[model samples]
Target: EPEVTQTPSHQVTQMGQEVILRCVPISNHLYFYWYRQILGQKVEFLVSFYNNEISEKSEIFDDQFSVERPDGSNFTLKIRSTKLEDSAMYFCASSVGTPKQYFGPGTRLTVT
Candidate 1:
């Protein structure tokens, strides 16, 4: 079975530093998305990408954030600056034009 893969599984950073989270989605999936769940908070959508373009984004995806498909096989999320509130578990998901999305194990970010 195909599955999404994420790297570094865990990250620890300073409040003002930058961080890049990486993921590789299922090979045949068409839509990709990024979401985050702050500790004790609900999972929130951050952005969705398809056809090498952004399809949708939430207010949480501010100027400080960006996503890229640097290689056909890999997707990345970059945060220009980190904050204490940025500590959370970031998930990467993909779907083949369906509401059922397959999610990665998630990368937990811890900012000090």
Candidate 2:
């Protein structure tokens, strides 16, 4: 089975800096999403993209954040200016509907 891949399993950065997390979503999948877990918090949806546009987005996906399908299989999340509150595990997910999401191990962002 194919798997979603993320880079820099761990990242440490000072607050207010820019960070771009990369993901290679599953091939042949149509829906993509970004979710986060703030330490002990539940996985919360940030955004979902389909057909080249945002299908839905949660309040957590604010102006400071952006996502793109830079290429066929590459999806990227960029935080223009990170905050201390942004420290969390960012997971990239994909599904062909039915909401059967497959998540990457995640890129743990640490801000200070």
Clashing pairs in 1: none
37-106, model 1: which lDDT tens digit per residue? 9999999999999999999999999999999999889999999999998999999999999999999999
Q: Rate the local accuracy (lDDT) of all candidates.
A: 0.97, 0.92
Off by over 4 Å in 2: none
Consecutive 10-residue window with the lowest summed lDDT within model 2? 96-105
For each candidate in turn, give its C-alpha RMSD to the true structure in angstroms: 0.6, 0.8
> Among all windows of ten consecutive residues in candidate 1, which has the lowest summed lDDT?
1-10
| lDDT score of residue 31 within candidate 2 | 93
